[model samples]
Target: MGRAFVYVILGGGVAAGYAALEFTRKGVSPGELCIISEEPVAPYERPALSKGFLLPESPARLPSFHTCVGANEERLTPKWYKEHGIELVLGTRVKSVDVRRKKLLTATGETISYKILLIATGARALKLEEFGVDGSEAENVCYLRDLADANGLVNVMQSCSSGNAVVIGGGYIGMECAASLAINKINVTLVFPEVHCMARLFTPKIASYYEEYYQSKGVKFVKGTVLTSFEFDSSGKVMAVNLRDGSQLPADLVVVGIGIRPNTSLFEGQLTLEKGGIKVNGKMQTSNDSVYAVGDVAAFPVKLFGETRRLEHVDSARKSAKHAVAAIMEPKKSGEFDYLPFFYSRVFGLSWQFYGDNVGEAVHFGDYSSGTFGAYWISKGHLVGSFLEGGTKEEYEAIAKATSLKPPVEDLAELGQQGLNFALTISKKPQPALPIEVSRSTSGLVLEKPVYAWHAAAGLVLTASIAGFAYWYGRRRRRW
Candidate 1:
C-alpha cells in the first residue's frame, strides 16, 4: 500500500490542524505533512484574546486581564502539528499558486511542491477604506485577524483615556470591542447603521435584549448612523469622528470591528467562491480534486440554514479540517462534517452561550426579564438552537450530544433529562493522545523506523513467562 505523500497545507489554523490530524490518524506519519503560516507565532484561539483577556480595572468593574492575542496568556502552545510529525513553516507567505504544477511560489521567491494541497488562508478583518483614524493615519488600520493585530491594539489601548470611542459596526466583534472599551470605563459610542445589534443573525427580540443588557451597563448606542470620515487633531490624533449625517462626535480612539472578508486573492479564479468564500463540497473538498479549503476561507452549505453561508466560528474550522483530512486519506470513501453552529461570549459578568441557528420561533424559559435564564429556538416545534446564561459543563456537553444524535429528539424535558442522565452515567471520554513515530515521509514515501525484531521477540517471551507464573499461582489458590 502507498505509505505517504507531501500534504502541503496553506494557512496554519484550526482547519489545517484538522487535516493534519486526519492524515496522521490514517497512518501517514508526521514527516509527510507540512504547514505554512504567515503569522510569526503559531495559531491560537481567537475568541478569548478579545473578550476574556481584555478585562479592565475600575471600582465598578472587575479585575481586568490582558486580552488580545498571545497563546502564552493561556499556556496553550501550538504543538498539534509539531507533535504529529508535521513540518511547520512559519513567517512565510504564499504569493501565488500554480495548481497545474502543484506548486506554490512564496513571496521570498521560493517554490514548494505538493501532491495534495489545502487552502485554509481564512479571512482578514474588512477595513472601511473610505474612513480614516485620527492619531496614526495609515491604510493599514487595526484589525484582530492575527496575533500581530491583537498586539498592536493592546499597545494602542495602553494610553487610551476615557474620552469617546466610535465603533463602526454592531456585529459580534464590534459589540465585543465596545463591551471591552466600556469595561475600561471608556466613554464608548457604538455606531450602527442598522436599527438593532446583530440584526443579520439575530431577531429583533434577541437583539433588543442584548442592546438593553449592554445599555444598562453604560454602553451608548448611536443607531441609524454611519461614519463618512475620521477627524484628527493638530497632533495627528483622531480627535473627532464625522458621520454621513453631517454629525461629528469627539473621539480619542476608534476600533472598527465591522467584519471580515476572505483572503483568496492568491488563487484568483482557480477556485470557486460563493459570497467571497471558497466553495467546498460536503466532504470539505474544493472544486479541484487535489485542492481543499477549510475554515473561514471556504463558503460551505449548511443544510439547516437551507442556503450556503460562510461560518466564522472557531469550531467550524476544527471540524471541517478533520473531514478534509479523512477525504484525503481515503479518496474512495465519502466524509461529511455538519455541526450546528455554536457561539459564546462573556460580557458584564455573564457567560452567554448560543447554539445552532439563532433564527425561528424561540421557545424561551428562565427569565430574560431578570437578565438571566435560558431560551431555545424552536422551528416547526423542533428544538433548533439554544441561548443560555449560567449553564454548567454538563449542560454544554449534553446539548452537544443531543445535536449529534439521529432521529431528532423533540421533547425538551426528555432531552434535558437524557442529557443529565448521560452525564451522570457515562465516564467522561478521555482525550486522545498523540501518536508516536520515529520517522515519517512527505513525498508519499514511508520511512522505516529503527526497531529490531529480536527486541520485540524478547518482549513477547517476557510477557508469556509472566502469564504462565500468574496461572500457576491461581491453580495453587484454587487447590487451597
Candidate 2:
C-alpha cells in the first residue's frame, strides 16, 4: 500500500516553498499535504546562492533568507511546516511518476500516491560536457544550482592557493560568481561566446558600461569566444581552459555558468510540452487534470506577451505557485494567471532591473557615462519594456507600472530624452495618445475611490467597512 496525500509538491525549490506557504494560508487539513524533495532542506531563497552565500564575510545561511521572507512574509522553516502538519519527505528522490496511477515511485522503492501533484522540479545547470568538453567532470569545476554547489564553491575558494578562476558563460551565474570570486581575492577571467556580458538583456553600450566597471575591479572579460576544452593535471583537476579563440587561461578553479535546461524529461511523453517545458493552462494545470506544473518546468501563458513561456526566475516561480494553489483551493473565484516578466541582477555594487519584452529599438536614456541610466524598448510603437540601474524605489515602481500599461511611444527620440520622467508621468494617469491602452477591467485606478473587494465587489458601499476591505484586499495581493 502506498502513502497518500491530497497535495504533493515535487521538487524543493522556490515554487514548492511558496506553494506550501500558500496552502497553509489558504487553509489546509493536517496530513493532507506533503512535499518531497531531493534536497535535505525545504525551499530556500535560490538567488542567494550566487549572492549572499558567496560573500567572503558572514554569508547568509539557512532559516534567515528562506522563502516568504523574500516576499516580506513569514519564513517557512522546518518547524513551521511541522506545526502546520505538512509532512516533508526530504533528501528523497522520486525515480519515476505514473500520472495514470497518480503515484510517485521513490528510488528507495517507496510509493507515494497523491490526489493532486504540483511539479516544481525547476531546472538543472547546463554542463560543459554537453558542449563537447570534459572539464565539467574535472575537480575544481563547480556549477551553482543548489545549496550543495554553493557550499562546495565556498570550500574550494577557501582552500585554493593560486587564487585564480576561469568562469564559463557570461550570463547571470557567470557575472555573479565572478564578482564573488574577485571579492575573495581570486583573479577571474570570464569567457563567453556573446559579444558582451548579459548579451540577452544589455545592449553593447550598456554592457560596455558594466564591463568597464568590472575591468576596474580587476575582472577580465574574454568575449566573442568560448571554451574549447580544459587542461587537466595528473590529479584530475582543471588547470587551464582552452578557448576557441586559440588562447589558453591557467585556472586554479573553474565555474561553469553556461545556462540551464528545464527538468522536464520525467514528464516528457507523459505530459504535453511547449516552449521547452510542460505545457500548462492559465490555471497551471497540465493535460492530466490532477497534475499541475509550476516554476521553470512549466510553460505557462505569459499574459503580457500573449504567449507561453517557461520563465526561469524566482518571481515567476513564487507567483505561479501561489496562483496554482489558489486555483485548486477556490476554483470558482480563481481566474487566469496574469503576469508580467521581471528579471534583475546585482553584481559588484551595481544593480539593474528589467520589465517586459526586450524587443524593437532600444532608446538609451539618462547619462550612460555613469551613475543612474537605463533604456526603453519601443516595440510596435508601444513602450513594451523598461530597464534601469541605480534607480530609486519610486523610479523602479514607475517603470514597472508604466511598462505594464504598454504605453505608446510616438517619438522615440523624445521618449529617450524624457526617459524616467515619461514613465513616471504615464504611470500616474491614462495617456491615451501615448500608447496607454489598458482594459477598463484591470486598471488599479478603478478601485482607488471604492472601498469594497475590487475583483468581486459590485456597486459602491457607503463606509469605512468597505474601504478597509478594499484596502486590505488590494494591498495583500497587489502584485498577484
Candidate 3:
C-alpha cells in the first residue's frame, strides 16, 4: 500500500515544513511523504534572528515552537516526521526536476521518483557583488538573511568600536538593522536612493513618519542618494561609501539590507516569471500543472493593489503555504489565499503597524510631531491602506474598517469623529469638487487627546465581518 504512493517536497523554508505537516494530517503515511531540505538544519524562525537574536541588549532567543536540530548535533533530535514514518532527506539539493518523468535528481547523484511534487524552493539574498559593487573588502559588509548571517553580524558588531556604520537601502530590513544597531548605541547612517524610506510600498506621509522616528532614535539619514562605490582601508575592511552624488560616507561597518531575490534558476525556462519572480495565481500554483511555488518565490496576487506582486513578509509565507497545500490536495476544490498584507516593526520605543497594501494616497488622522498617530490611504474612494505609529487598538480597528470596505470619499473640511461617521455613509449625489489632495502642510500641530477602546472594538468587528464574507465567497467559488 505504501509503495502505491510517494510525494516529494523540495526546499526547506516555512512553506516546505508546514506543507509536510499538512500532508501527514491527511493520512498520507510517513513512507509516502518525503521532504528533501537543502539546508542541513531543520527549519527555524528566521525573522527573530535578525532583530532580537543579534541585538545583545535583547533577551530574545529562538521561539520554543518548532525547534530545529543541526546535522552535526548528536542529540538524536526527536524527529516529528520520523515518529510518523515520514522520510526526511537533509542537506540534499534537488539538482534538477524532470516534471514530465515525475523524477528529482539530487546532488548526491540519486534519482527519486515522485507521484507528485511540490516546489517550495523559496529565495536567497542577492549578493552585493551581484549588483556590481565590487571590492575585496566585503569582509566588513554584512547581509542578513539566515541565522548564520545574524550570528556573523553580531560578531562584526562586537569586533568594531563606536564608529560610523553605513547601511545601504532604506527598506524594511535595512531600517530594522539600523534600529537594532542604534539600540546598542552604535552610530548608524542610512542611505536610500529614493527621497523617502519604503517609497516603493508606502506613501510619502507614512515614509516621513518613519524618517522622523528613525531620526528621533539618533539614526542619521542620507536620503535621495545611491551607493555608487565602496572604498576600503589598508586592512581589507570597508571604510567609506561613494554616493551617486559628489559625496562619500565614512564607514566602519556596512550592512546591505537592500532586498531579496527568488531562487528560480532551478526551474529556469520551465516556469513563468514576472520581472524575474515566479508567477503564480491565487492558488499558489506555478505555470506547470503539478508544480506549486510559495514564499518569496511565488508571485501571488494582491486584490487591493490589483497586481500579482511578490511579498516577502512572514505572514504572507504562512498563508501562501496553506494555499499551496490546498491546491495540491484538492486542485479541483482548493481556494486561494487572500490576506491583507500586514507588517509591524519596532524602531526605538515606537511600534509602527501597517495593514493592507499601500497603493493609494495617504490621509493623516493624528499628529506626527509627538511621535504618535495614524494615517489612512484612500484608493478610488475606498480605504486601501493605513499606518499607525505608537497606535492603540482602537486606531488599528479604525484602519481595519477603513481597509475592509469601499467607503465613499470623505470631506477634508469635515474630519474628526463626525468625519469618520460621514465616511461610513456613501454619497450618491455628485461631489462639489473632484477629490482634493491634502498633505501634511504644517510640521507642528497640537492634536486632540486619544479616544476610548469602545470606539475601536466596534470598528474592528465591522471590518472582521467584511473579511469573513470575502473568505466565504472565495471558499464557495472553490467548491464550485
Please name the candidate that would achieve the greatest lDDT relative to the true structure.
2
* Best model per TM-score: 2
Instruction: Give the TM-score comparing model 3 with the true structure, all chains together.
Output: 0.78
Candidate with more favorable, higher lDDT: 2 or 3: 2
Name the runs in model 1 displaced over 4 angstroms. Answer: 1-5, 56-84, 130-141, 331-334, 397-480
The predictions' CA RMSDs to the true structure, in order, are 14.4, 9.1, 11.4
Residue pairs clashing, model 3 = 30-85
Candidate 3: RMSD over Cα atoms? Answer: 11.4
Q: Residue 418 deviation, candidate 1, in Å?
A: 16
Q: State in Å the error of residue 114, model 1.
A: 0.5
Error of 3 at 82 (Å): 3.4
Candidate 2: which pairs clash? Answer: 408-434, 408-435, 451-466
- Per-residue CA lDDT of candidate 1, range 1-480, in tens? 122338888996656655665676788865877778897665556665567556665321111221111222222244545676777778998888877778888888878888899888988877677345343343223566666666666556666756666777898778888888788777888888999988766667767888887888788888897877777656567767788778888876777777888888977788877878888887777788889888888887665454567888777877777678877788678556565677777777767677666655555555567665565555544455666666677776655544322123367665444433432233254423533233323421112333566767888999999999999999999999
- The lDDT of model 2 is 0.88
Ranking according to TM-score, highest score first? 2, 3, 1
Give the whole-model CA lDDT for all candidates, comma-separated: 0.68, 0.88, 0.70
